[model samples]
Target chain A: MSTLLAFLLSNHLKSRFVIGYTLILLLVSSALFIFTDNPQKGLLGGVNLVLLFVPLVVSLYTGISLYHGEDFTRVLLTQSLSRNQVYWSSTGSLQLSLQAALLVGLGIPLLLFAPGMPAVALLAGASILSLIFSGLSSLIAFRVNDKVKGIASLFLMWLAFTLVFDGLILLFIQLMSDYPIEAAVIFINLLNPVDMCRIVLMQVLDAAALMGLTGALLTEYMGNLFAILSVLLALLIWLIVPMELSRRSFLNKDF
Target chain B: MLHVDSLTKKFGRLEVLNSIQLEFQKGTVTGILGPNGSGKTTLIKCLLGLCHFEKGNIALNAISIKSEKEYKSYFGYMPQIGRYPENMSIGDLFELLVSLRNQPENELDLELWELFKLENIKSQRLGKLSGGTVQKVSAALAYLFKPEVIVLDEPTAGLDPLATEIMKEKIRKESSGKITLITSHILNDLDELCSHIVFLNNHKIAFSKSMKELKASRQGLTLNQIVAQLLQGEA
Candidate 1:
């Protein structure tokens, strides 16, 4: 498995798309730090960028690369290795490559300018989100064999998680303003990895106070440690469920 | 020995192969002949475990395919169109496959590798190779591991005349002491290379017989004429 993983990672590293992605992240984060006077302000921008950009790029890139490598995957399946090894190694290589890009692209700037718990939180949140989306992409790639349909579905998923879900939650809260629904809203928010990541970053950045009622309710209901732990748990679930589902589908799929 | 018993497969309500039963002993080269969409590929895919079958089982050397993946080590396959990673150089691809197999270097079969002169183009990326060259690569990799059962899908479809002759000679050389299964539209090639031939039509085997039996049954008729007569009879 490691041999396959190393080979896939080498192939991925040589691609122009990955290099361009890494360079874009490096440039954007570096510029954010250099131009802003306050590191916290830059961290705030970084959070939004990570939340908006990371999932979209990771999901699309992983999906497309998997499709492109479909033929090679067939070749691998014929070898002595188990299907689990092939699926995991290919997905692992994609996840690790993207995460490394995130770390280098965002890690350097955060450490150089804003070295604190908030910076660490930002990095962790971004890395976990990248992994979560990679898993989703793998699931899509395995489940939908057609390349165009798979990509379309991936874009829809990113839009739902990042944008549409938040809007629906806001509408739900607005419509049920008379009732005590703080717990329900919080539970619903937990379902969206993007929102949970944002909450974690905001809490650590001391910007939770800016969240108004939601922020106050979050702090009052669940302590800082509990909130972070629960969010991390949610993120972990997001990572495992999709990956496991994809693995099963891949094992049984006809090449 | 390779044994396939009552194998049945379907793809979304369309039956591709129905009750396929076959057996091959060592040193026997069987040609799988069929028209387009006649389940030739599906049958081969079933044998390789690439396509899941609805019923029946396949056993190689008395080991069932459903038991564990260890049985797959005995087989080597060459896909009709070899699609490798575009950026991967031939050397790296060979190294990867060699390491995965973990066979001793001295025991490796370098006959096809040296004959194809792949060493000279070791650094070339797979995407840059011509179709015939890619076919050569697939052919070499299939024989590199010295598998007990070898499957070649359209082995000489895109090759130049010289390469085609070279492949046929290699097949002849390796056919002894190994079970070789080939699927091709070129009857002349099969006539020259295969000891036995299996014909598939309408999702089932039409006939399977040795070359001598087929020739004796239809005196003075070439394989092409024999197969054409069979198809006409069915029509």
Candidate 2:
């Protein structure tokens, strides 16, 4: 597993694009944390970037890496390792490296500028989201054989999760405005990993009111502890389901 | 020994391998010969447990290949193209494979590395290497573990004459107590290296016979001529 991690890092470390992106993240994080008047607000400001950029970047980067790593994966498969071992090692490496990059690029700034529980919670939430999206991207890339199509689908997945899904939910709630749908809204929110992260952070940062009545009602129904645990569980499912499915498909696949 | 019993495979509606049956015993080198789209690669993939077959079974040393992964440790595979991550240096690639194998570095067979002169370009990225260089790397890696079962798909496609001769010599040496399966369009190499030949055509095994019997069956014709006649008969 460490060799696999080393392999991935060796390849990733050579890419100028990854280095540039991480540098940009560092600059953005430092600026966001340093410019805010209140540490809590500064952490919140960073959360917005984590919510929007981390998933997108991680997904895109992971998708491309998986595609490029196809040959490397085949080499490993022919070795003494099993398919399960290879699959998990690849995913584990991606998770660790991407999360490390996020933590180093952003976490240090958060710690230096805003040292508190909210900073810790936000970093954890962002790291989890990174893991979930990297898994999701790997699964998507493996399912599609064509590189161009695989990358396009990855972007589409992120767009759907971040933008289209929420839009549809809003439309649904407006359509069902006459009905009592707080439970349904909470259920829907848990289904999307991004929303799960948002809700979990809201619990930690006491920012649930921004979600309007649905958020307030969800906070009341599940309470802070339940919300955090459920979101963590949801994120775990997001990370595992796609990775397991990808492993099964990869094992059965030809070439 | 390796046994393939009535193995069948299909890609959607197109059947790639149809009830294929073959066997490889110890100390024998079998050359898998086929035309374009004859399912030679598909057959090899099935044996390696990379492609799922619809019917029949493949066993190595009496162990079934179905959902069996540890069995892979017994074999070494050199792919046709030998593509790898573009940015990985040759030295790092070797280290990665050794690490993945979980075997001690001292256990690796460094013969091919020395013979192929790979150490000279150890620091070169895989993407920067030529096709022949990549084939050398693949060959070196395949034989690094000194596995019991070795499969080479067009292993000499991009290799120069010196490298090709070195690879052929290595395969011949390893065939003493191992099962070596090779697929190559170069009939001369097949005739010179293979002790047995398995001819595949139209998704089925046309014939599988020892080189002695195949040579005896056709009086004056070369192995290439015999194979052409066999393929024409199939059509």
Candidate 3:
């Protein structure tokens, strides 16, 4: 399994898309730090960038790569390895490669400029989000065999998670504005990894003002440790469920 | 021996393979002959576990395929259309497969590799290789592991005369004590290479007979003529 992982990682890292992604992240993060007067403000700017871009980039990249790697997967399936091993190693290698890119491209600037827990939280959130999207994209790739359809579905998924989800939450809150639905809003937010990650970073930054209604309520009600732990739990679920589902589909799939 | 018992597979409501049953013994080359979309590729895929069957099981040497994946270690499968990672060089690809197999250098079969002169183009990216060259690569990889059971699907579809002859000679030499399965539309090649023939039509085996038996039954007819007569009779 490790051998397969190493082999796949080497192949992926050599691709132009991954290299270009790393360079773009490095350039953007460095420019954000160089231009902003306050590192905290730059960190906030970084948060928005990471939140908006990480899922989109990771999902599209992982999905397209999975489609492109179908031939390699077929070859591997004929080897002396179980389908489970191939599925995990391929997805695991993709997730690790993207995470490495995130760490290097964004980690260097954040550590150099905003070297604190909040910066660490931002990096952690981004890494988790990368993993979450990788799993989701793997599921999409395996579930939908047609490349164009799979990719279209991936785009729709990213849109739903990152943008449409939040809008729906806002609508739900407005409809129930009469009651004290703070706890319910927080519960609903837990379903979306993006929202959960944003809240986690906001909690770590102690920026209640920027955290919208659910984040502010979470800050007011729960202790810092409890809030972070709970959000981490939600993110962990988001991480495992998609990956497990995809793995199952891959095992039974006729390639 | 490789045994397939009552195998059935379907894509949605369309059944591709139904109740496939066959046993391949050592020292025998079985040619799988069928029209396009007659589940020839699907049968090979099922044997390699590349396709999931709804019922029945396959066993190698009395060990169930589902029991473990170790059975696959003894299989060398050459796909009909070889597809590989585009950016990977031929040398790196060979290195990866070699490392995965982890067999000793002395035991490896590099006959196809040397015959095809793949070493000369070791640095060429797989995506840049022509279809015939890719077929050469696939053939070499299948035999590199020196597997006991060899499955070649359309092995000579795009090969030039020289390469095709080389592949045929290699298959003839290596098939001495192995279970060889080859699927091809070219009956002449199958006539030259196969010891037994299994004809599939409409998702089931129409007939399976040894070369001697088939020849004895159809006195003066070649395999092509026999198949044509059979198709005409069915029509």
Candidate 4:
């Protein structure tokens, strides 16, 4: 497992795209800090851009590149390990390494800008978001088995969650113009990881913006801890269910 | 020892291997001969557990393939056409396989590596290697781990005379107390290397006989004539 991790992480670090992405994050976060009216907006924008996009893009790329060399898959089968072990180790190596990049790439800027939240809670929230997407994108890549398709799925999901979800939310707001629909919008937002990104970062960035129903519920419910824990649970389910499906498919479906 | 007992595999509607039963003895090489689309490659895939064998059990050394991974531990495979990660250098690829195999005690044979003068190309990616060189790498990797059983599909598919000789010698020398199964469209190579010939025709074994018996059955006839007679009789 350690060797697999080392093998994967070393490769990830070697990639030009990953290095470019990290540099882009460093520049954007640094520039945002310099220009914004306050640290809150800078942090929110940083989390939105760096955190969300990086995990989705990096994990998808990792899956495609990892299996591109299938001659090694045959070599692995000739060893004393089980097929399940082979798939798990390979997939786990990819997931863990990509997640590590997500951490170093995004976490550095995030901490530099927003230093209020307990490091543990911030980590928990980021992990929830990371786990959800990485597991899903990994599963999609394995099933699709083509670079174009793997990348396309990530873009499509990004479209649905980040853009389309907000469009629908606005339509609902227009429909319920007479009533205060902020509460309902909050609940609807939970369905999208983008919204969780907003709510999770809300405390660090403009605690006032979180006066909406979801934020109030989170801030008021069992405090931010409970809310973060709930999101983490939701993301954990995302990880568990899809990973189980992917593993079963990998084990039985002929590669 | 390797046993493929009544192994049946199908690809959609095509029944590739139908009740294929065979046993391989250690310290000898068995040649699998068949015309195109005669389930020779399918049998090799089934043996590697690369394809699902629907109606048969494979055993290695008395342990069922399902019960343990001893079967794979004994196998070193050279695919007919190997597609490697083009981005990786040959040395890196070799090291990667060694690491993936958990650094097995048996090292990969580099006789052909030196014979083919691949030392210069060690840092070159797999994409840069020529067809014959690729064949050498595939063959070298198959014998490299020095596994107890080796499977080569079209072992000498693309090679010059000198390289082919080097490969054949490696196959013969490495088969000591081990089994080497090779499938080839070319009969001459098999005639030179195989101790046992397992001929496939119409989804079944046309003949599984020792070299001595095959020679005896030929009655001074050439291998081609004897094989033609055997296959014609089967059809």
Pairs of colliding residues, candidate 2: none
Q: Write the per-residue lDDT of candidate 1 for residues B1-235, one digit (tens) a residue.
A: 8999999999999999989889988999999998789999989988887878899999998998876468778888888989887778999999999998879998888888898999999999887899999999999999988989999999999999988999999999999989999999999999999999999999999888999999999999999999999889988
Enumerate residue pairs that collide in model 3.
none
- lDDT of prediction 4: 0.71
Question: Residue by residue across A116-148, what tens digits does model 2's lDDT show?
Answer: 888898888888889889888888888898999
Give lDDT tens digits, candidate 4, residues A8-31. Answer: 455555566556756775676667
Q: TM-score for each prediction? A: 0.95, 0.90, 0.95, 0.80
TM-score of chain A of 2: 0.93
What is the lDDT of every predicted structure here? 0.90, 0.85, 0.90, 0.71
Report the error of model 4 at residue A50, Å: 4.1
Q: Ranking by DockQ, best first? A: 1, 3, 2, 4
Q: How much is the lDDT of residue B121 in candidate 3?
A: 99
What does each candidate score in C-alpha RMSD?
1.8, 2.7, 1.8, 4.3
Q: On residues B1-235, what C-alpha lDDT tens digit does candidate 2 reach at each position?
A: 8999999999999999999988999999999998889999899988887778899999998877864666888888898887787788999888878876767888888999999988999999988999999999999999998888999999889899999999999999989999999999999999999999999888999889999999999988888999889878777
lDDT of 4 at A79: 60
Query: Which lDDT tens digits does candidate 3 get at residues B16-127?
Result: 9989999999999999987778899899988998888899999999878885478889899898888887778999888888887768888999999999999999999887
Question: Which residue runs does candidate 2 get wrong by more than 4 Å?
Answer: A13-17, A34-41, A220-222, B66-70, B99-108, B215-219, B229-235
Which of candidates 1 and 2 reaches a greater TM-score?
1
Give the poorly placed runs of model 3, Cα more than 4 Å off.
Answer: B232-235
Worst 10 residues of 4 chain A by lDDT: A117-126
